[model samples]
Target: MRTIYKKELARIFKDKKMVFSVFLLPVLIMVGIMALVGNLTSRQMEDIENHESIVYMMNEPESFTAFLDASDLHMDVKSVETEAERDDVMSMLKEGDADLFIEFPENFDSLIQGYRQGDEVPQIKTYYNPSEDYSSSAYELISNQSLEAYRQVLLSQRVTDMNELQVFTVNSDNKDMVVQDDQKASGKALGMMLPYFITILLFAGAMGIGTDMIAGEKERGTMASLLVTPVKRKSIVLGKVFALMTISGISSVIYIVVMGATFPKILGGDSGLDLEITPEQIVMIGVLLVAIAFLYSAIVILLSVFARDLKEASTYITPAYMVVLVIGMMTMFTTREAGMKDYLIPFYNTALALKGILTSEVTMAQYGVTLAMTLVLGGILTAVIAKAFESEKVMNL
Candidate 1:
């Protein structure tokens, strides 16, 4: 077994194409994806962090400006002399130069005071960029904050009008949820891309290395030569399958390392969730590398053994990868509590495990179970491949 393994390693290292397929290509794909994610996250963070609500105050509120001065929000409020000025600010906000545009109509303070006294109706016209999604979103957030402030002021005014000696306060009993905190906007972003990354690495490692192991051997007449050896057919299949698993495992490690190195810079801007990686994270990632590599390699080796050539092998593996890809993508579109079915599903298990590791909630039992299942599946696949290798039809081909 040692001799066979050594020889297989030598052949893989000697073949530049195989080396590229097993190692370099997967790393490139991973780095490319990480880079793209970093760019997108940076842009998104910038949009969130530097988003300054552009308040084009057409009518001045005596207290509104003072209230804004006491707050920590980033807002670019300018007194607009005409509709043209307001339009310019609106255009800038739409172009992502500003977070949002706010317009206060004339008699804003008087109308609000009158409404508080129940002597007249309150009408405040605020112009917001409805077309810009972020601008509109910011408008809603600012509006909520503004409304809360208005409610507080109105309540105080009502208390004074009623001649109440004691001041009343309103407090919410809502608990600060941990899971809700974990699934923040940035966490959702991580969840959205993390699964796809795992699936891509798994698919690439399996397909790239597995295609060359079986189909490539047939194409090179090596299968026929190996069949003549005194070694047991099962040993040959095990050696090749083990070799594929090693290659895939190394590729996955490198890919994860690249992702870890790039994550901080990618999610640095305004993504409230920290992308800081720790030693524990590194360990969890290593476990994932081994588990997914074995699982995918076993599946691909089974598919590859049935193909006569690389093209046919790809035909089978491509569709299999597409299925995994779709399942992996479900983590993005669906909520965490979406379905219990995802827990039992193979690809989904890997995806969820990766997600857990990233979010710092991976359990020892889940890791052990995933690893055990992968090994069991790989062992079963080895048995099947062994039988095929000893068959008259497979040897004849």
Candidate 2:
């Protein structure tokens, strides 16, 4: 077993191209893609914040105009009272040339001041293009800041005693209002999507390595030579499967490390991601990751054994890869808790476990189920592969 393992490692290491593809390429691709997305997203947000979108006001109120003049919103507002002028502004909004239009009710200020019970509420209608990003952002800023401030001002002006209109304040000092769990919060964001990427990455690496190590060797007649040795068929299977698992394990660590270190810095910007992984959680993640690697490797290697050549093996594995991707993606938006019974399923359990670990939500029993079931299934498949190896018809071309 040791000899076969050492020989396989030597043969793989001798191929520099394979080593680079299996290990280093994943790091570079992850870094490059994350960096590019981060820069583009940040730049877009900054541009929107700094942009001065054109705003048009109809039926202008003297008080509102004065309020706008006194404030520091820096909005560019145009007064278009004529029907023809309003139509022109509407065209500009649809064309993405204008952002927002505000139309106040006639006698807007007088109605607010003299309002009584059952009296009609003063209305302020806003128009903007929802399809345009600038228009949507400008609408949000104006609505949240300028319009809300004006409404508060009107309320205070209408009441004799400002104290009478006000209810008790809640968290006036806004900074201390939120009880933040930075680790848990960041984990929630990551938990939604990281499992999918990790699952895809493990299977992707295993797919190529498994096919080449088994199917490619069989096609080239190298596996036949290895099988004739004095070592038992089980040992040969163990040696090859361990070698596959080693590559899968190393690849898994590389991907997780690279993604963990860089994704926070890039995509998260100043608010970086911090996973609250204790020693125990770290150990669970490691154990779960290994179980998944074994599962993926065994699945691929079994398919490779049944194939006459690399192309035929890939044909069989392609559908399996697609199925894995679908399973991984299913949990990307998972919000509800996963029952312990959910952990009995294969690829799904791994995804759920990772999500729970990141969010600090998974229990010991869930992890136990995922680990036990995965390893048992992998061992069963591996034993099947060994049995197949002993058959003359299965080994020979």
Candidate 3:
């Protein structure tokens, strides 16, 4: 078994194309994504810091309008008198001229104070064009800050002394923040990066290892020659399967290492998001890596078992690429601290585990369950593929 493993590894590295595909491709893809993400994060942070976004208010009281002037955020505040003007402001937001439009109803003062006096809460509508990412983000920030300011004013009404001390009593002591930087535990960069890297790695494994193990061997006639040897047919199948899994494993590790080594510097330099990932978190990421390798390779092997030749195997494996890619993207869409529903997903578990490891909250039970599922699913795929290999038709093909 050891000899077979060494021989397979040697064979893979000996092929320059295979070595580049299996290793270098994933690294390049990861670095590219990190650079793009880091740039976007930096731009967003800059917009937050420097952009004087405009928000138009209608029928707002002097007190409420004064609150926007006193706030820390940079804003080009304006007042509107009619619905047509409000529509014009919304058009400006849609045209990329204004950030957002805050529509205060004609009875704004009465409605706001009435709501505070245990009456129905008045709806405060903020119009934002969804097509603009920064605009939407700015709208949400301003709306939240405005609501906070309103709350502070109401709270101040109760205090005999309306000073900065009242702001401190209502603000600082009221909210609790629990920070968990667990995403680093998953062995990827901060934010929506780990999932992208995982998806790319899955594609590399399916295309590089999957194509080479099945199709490339057929093209070289090595598989046909190996079958005629004295070794048990099942051993031959297991040997190739193990080889492909090893290739997949290596590819996964390359992705983790490239991202891990570059992420801190990228974050500090451009993204400006800092994190502290421990050695134990890396161990958990390793657990996820092993699980994904075996699971993905087993499935690819099963698909390859049906191929008549190398060209046919590559065609059959295209869907494997699609499935893994979609799953990784879906995992990216979901926030970290994944709920019970995420636990049931297959490819998602690995990404989730990676996210948890990166963020630092990966539990032993989560790792155990993810590992078990990978083994069970991989075992089923291996058995099915082995059975296919045992067929005289497949062997002959």
- Candidate-wise lDDT, in order: 0.70, 0.85, 0.71
TM per candidate comes to 0.67, 0.88, 0.68
Clashes of each: 0, 0, 14
The list of candidate 2 runs beyond 4 A from truth reads 84-88, 107-119, 221-234, 267-269, 390-397
lDDT of 3 at 2: 53
By descending TM-score, how would the candidates be arranged? 2, 3, 1
For model 3, residues 1-397, the per-residue Cα lDDT tens digits are 4555567778888999879867887688768877788789788878666777777778777777667667766777788888788778878888988878777666877666556556677677778877886577677778777766776786577556767563345346545564543344333345356766676676556565666676677678887887777877667667777777777777777877787678777666544355666778767777667767777777777777777666787788777778777777775676546765666678777667666666655577776777787778888888887788778787666
Tens-digit lDDT string for candidate 1 (81-170) = 788877787777667666555566577777766664446555555556677656676677667677568657756765666446547644
The better candidate by lDDT, 1 or 2, is 2
Local error of candidate 3 at residue 324 (angstroms): 4.4
Q: What is the C-alpha local distance difference test score of candidate 3?
A: 0.71
Q: What's the residue-level lDDT of 197 in candidate 1?
A: 81
- Report the number of backbone clashes for model 2: 0
Worst 10 residues of 2 by lDDT: 268-277
